[model samples]
Target: MKQDVQPLIVNVKRYTLVRNLVFGWLTVVLFAGFLLNFPKINILEHTARNLYFHVPMWFTMMAAAFVSGYHSLKVLQTGDPLRDIRALQAARIGTFFGILGLSTGIVWSRFTWYVGTDVWWNFDPRQIMVSIQLLIYGGYFVLRSAFDEPNRRAKISAVFNLFAMTALPFLLYVIPRQMESLHPGAEGNPAFSQITHPVMRLVFYPAIIGFIGLFWVLYTQRVRVAWLKYRVTQDSEM
Candidate 1:
């Protein structure tokens, strides 16, 4: 007789520690984002404070993207349903954060980069490329839904997930830098570091850490729920 191995959803004590720490850290980050004084820049003014929220979201999304990709790779190698669950949930949450980043970036740009103009959708390279990258992730989800069988679905979606993950860096960084864009580090624009003040960096760096921590907490919870659902249904769609 063959022995069945159980999946570890999460380590309860460690998960609790991480979840609480992320919540506390994010509370500080959000509070300090608005309360602390930021150096006002030309056309940015107080909106510069959005740096703590907006930029960190992209970092979180990027972290989630690579995480999703890594799990998807494992799914292909081991054919584990748990890895599939993680890959799907990570991409879903990552896409959610990516949308938030894009939306926040749009709001930030309107006030600073495109002041007094009615052009809200001017096809900025950074914006368009990010949108395309998100759509590719969208395709990954839809591809999962197309297959009724769990094993087949997991395998096929893992392949698609890998592709989506592989494309993320190019879409977010490489291609955007090559074109003229409203965002930093594009077409002769100054680098973010050179332009940023040290005082602002204090919060900026921590904000990235906090948001990435938040992503993990959320992803872990979702994985746990998916594990439960899989126990009941033997399917990992949720």
Candidate 2:
């Protein structure tokens, strides 16, 4: 029973934009106007509004991390060097999305938590710790570049990435629940139920799909660029 439904879901997700383009665009246009017409729908009104950007950022990061882990596992099994490159590329994508997530979150937090303050950042527990998560990836990239040997770089990086899952338990699971956050919601707690009107739900869901698709397209392009650069470097070395 499970096997029968799995492929169906996979196929639909794979062709989301293709199957729903007309509806997707209509939703896009509607959400665009809805957000504009009702400025109060934004994070300015409440942290619920941050869902448009913040949730997508986290989604993108998870997508990137999934790619990274898949490639890492392949490299582990097949000893393929290209898989390592792919994993690195995916990790880089995650890093980019992670930084954006932090920045957008700070913007949302500033008005909600630290109103009238000259400086925007604060030591909010979740905020401080997410920054640490960001730094962990940053350190991964730095370590990747710092190593002179390719095999050594790939091995060390793959090992380092395994530890990232450790932070997830803390950052994603604990801090949001334990601390008194200025951010509206906690891990399991309901922040605001008021924002989930039918109009918002209709537009917001499609907007999320569109944004994620947009990020995937960019990721593919970046992978292509990295492959081309690798080819050039290989040709020159030969």
> How many clashes show up per model?
0, 0
lDDT of 2 by residue, 103-186 (tens): 887887777657788557877777787778778878877877777777776777777876764565578547776777665466
What lDDT would each prediction earn against the true structure? Answer: 0.90, 0.65
TM-score of each: 0.95, 0.74
After best superposition, candidate 2 residue 34: deviation in angstroms? 4.1
On lDDT, the candidate that comes out on top is 1
77-150: candidate 1 lDDT, tens digit per residue:
99998899999999989998999999998888877778889667779998999999999999998999999999
What lDDT would candidate 2 get against the real structure? Answer: 0.65
Q: Per-prediction RMSD in angstroms?
A: 3.2, 7.5
lDDT of 1 at 236: 93
How many times do residue backbones clash in model 2?
A: 0
